[model samples]
Target: MSGYSGTDCQIPSVPSSFAPGHGEGLEDKGCGNGTWTSVEQLVAVPVRPFTFTEAPQTITAGGQYGVLEYHGSISKPHHPGEAEFYLLRGVLTENEAAQLLATCSQALSEAIGSGKGRDLDVDGRPRFAVEVAELGVLDGKGSALRPLVETVLLPLVRQKYGQTAALSSACFRRFVPEERRFIPPHQEYDSFAVMTIALQESASYTGGFFLQGSGKAFVDRKFLQLGRGDLCIFQYDLCHGVDVQEGSHLELVLHFKDSPQAVADGSCPWYSKMVEVGDPDGLFGHALSLVKKDFPAAKEFVEKACEQDHVEALYTAAEWFWDSPFGLEESQNSSASVELWRRAAELGHCRSRSRLGSLLMQGVPGRLQQDIWEGKRLLRLAFEQDDPDAAFHLGQALLQDGDRDGVTKLLAACAKGHPRACFQVAELYREGQFQFPKDLRQSVRYTKWAAHQGDAQALSNLGHLLINGMGVVKDEAKAVRLFRHAAKLGAAEGMLNYGLALLRGSGGVKVDYQEALEWAQKSAALGHSLAHQQCLGGSFRD
Candidate 1:
């Protein structure tokens, strides 16, 4: 343990935290007196956990995200109908908000006289931009405002980009009654999305109008009604700013992103100072904290660190070169990558051992020579260390070669919520494939679990089963909604099924022939065979 100058093996290399989307609901309890009693789980909060809900099938304003309307209808010609921002009312209590504002206003008050922090004249006003990181240690305690922002931003980012937003940045802002008293419509390029929270009562400020707009002149405006302790979050692309008049107005501005590359590489001086002190873990962390945002800087830093005999960086670099962003790419023909993994594996990097073992067992042509015995040995070592990837690869290989022990390995991966392994095992149980007896209950369990991760195929499959009353109870309406969601995610089968459901009114939903036809066409374009019949204007059949 002393010799290994890398991450401790006891901790998991991957993030395993997950919370399902649910709203607070009540159920009536039956009483002996033939009456019903209702009870509630009360919540008193600094910030309330937002209730996760999906938009029902309807053509109207604001489905999931808040309404970002173009014309009267939500549908814009260029992009799919999705709002850029939403409102969360009463995230904090007035007292809690006062605590936040007191910090910001106090910092602003200090910045006005003292020659600390960067100086700037925002909109011709004598203002200062003092970062929260500097004031974080004011009372020798930095409130976890960034983590709080991340918790709220995570689900929204996933809904927008189909992935997680892992990092966040924040600052405090104040608007006073003097001067023009507002920043005009402008967007910050430095963030994926921005969370603008009202730290004081709307009654306190006369004209603190938060507006979002687009175009050169910025004419079309959506003036949002953000009250005290309320949050108005919008994407970076949306042009937004606020105006305040006749009173003191304060706000907590926060930024979120899928990657912390910018934050790590000197965007925030506080974080930069922490990572600049030399550690491959920082570089490796940036690589893992990304999915949709294909940042080259993360790859550059991690790969560079690996060349310096950096243990953690080499493990990440191997993953980057070999099969990055969820092991979807195995065709990369870089022998240097394998060698890097080998070096890391020899140095007691557990994940490197897992990855290199999978590759060496199969052997990339002209890149790696097959050595199944050694590969299995390495995988066993990693599996003994409880690496999920090792468990999957080892289990899949063994199962394919007619070994019952492989199922245990696949189940091991499934236990860690590995979606692919879950899908594999689910399909096996459903079809009775690879010596697994057909177990609809087990199949449904795994399929539903994988679908929760927003896998398009898993969603489509689960919908199919739900509609057919296979494994689970019949819920055609719910299944149709799943199809619609999966279709939006570019699943061909989902598109086909959703089109059919819409056309036939299978879900007790309103029939829209035009929309059904459009979905059918999309499915057909994506090579769904069933869609061709409908797209060709033939008789409807599934």
Candidate 2:
């Protein structure tokens, strides 16, 4: 389900072939002068597609200096939200592209080609020749490519979806040749429509062709033979992927969704517009801009903005300070950060209160002075305010103290989809620790919930259970896949488990001593004790 329907609305089959670009093949379903007795009847009433046409010149004349082709779906109930795509042919001059490439390449060097602990595919090879995190480069105010999306891409989406669609994700993807380069077909989630812009000439890549799949067989297939600026749009639910053969390829993907509104009195408003219209100095706007960039500067900016008594800035600053590596100074004394959290908590920020409580439980003795009683009190207050984090932390504390009330609190948090609480509940069920009953099936179920939220430990633990047939049928291949995914998320334990699997040739994984050794070394570097021993001991024979 989408926000449109709680129950599964019928997903219609893709028409064999429709107009390729723009609103060329829309049928007018005239329901003129029809009276509807209820909202349901009104929805059932057919509507005609509004008149729309190709407006490349109009778009270009609006200070959009680019040579690109655009294809858009008509805004109608029949269409699955605003779907549009652009081909980036000469939209960016060579000089401009080169400049952007250089700037981003330099800015994101660490993230590029730096697979610190990513796992190999089943073939024991890297997934891509190069997979750059180009989003990091474009997230800041300094990014040259920001305007291309904010100025051009967003406006095009608004033209099709009206002004209510907000940009969900704008991603720049680069694919290069590798031993196994083709992407497996997959479906997208959390978005209504996806628009992809080709950034490279077809000749640059070999055999890497985009195909639209109906989650099974291919409905339509197209090679990269289209010109660079050729654009494609598809409903997010439609399965799509590229068959990579050789050379390099680059693309820009824009995901759109209906903007969530704070005040949904049936009249929807763009979330960004609400922010812009509320604060006089656009304080939230400035805070958002800073938060999107380097974390250190973002912290400083939020701190300065908080001086103006901006609640959002106070909460944002507290959050940035609470997150490790981003907020923690090298000295590791979080007294100053804790004070910020306390200040935000004093200002009635529920999340900040919860965060402050959690930090206080750590007993970080400093300017704020750790007090267990005060921490628990704040946790109770925050929990009463219906803060999920507060419930999770308080539940954990209570459980540690052998209090049964923690079980109810944890279940409440789990019901709300709190990943940590789900993981905790899963652990309790697995071990029958504290007040939980021993149930491996329940463990697997809750672990799955946590894993889906990207909990690395849950993924790794679930892999173990899957391979051992603890609560489910044994699936060695699935276990290996889960371990690989968990390892890719920088889980040291996942790396060690995956390495051991390679060493023993378990989970259908072929024995590759060199690869196993590499994974062992990586896990050891991340402070996994067993991996350290595995790295030191020459037990695996090549």
* Highest lDDT model number: 1
lDDT of 1 by residue, 476-512 (tens): 8888888888889888878878878877888887877
Which whole-number lDDT from 0 to 100 does residue 500 have in model 2? 74
lDDT of each: 0.57, 0.54
Q: Supply candidate 2's per-residue lDDT for 370.
A: 71
Give the Cα-based TM-score of candidate 1 against the true structure: 0.44
Candidate 2 Cα outliers beyond 4 Å, as residue runs: 1-281, 292-301, 321-333, 364-369, 490-492, 518-542
TM-score of every candidate: 0.44, 0.48
Which portions of model 1 show Cα errors greater than 4 Å? 1-304, 319-333, 359-378, 432-437, 488-492, 508-542
What lDDT does candidate 2 reach at residue 47? 17
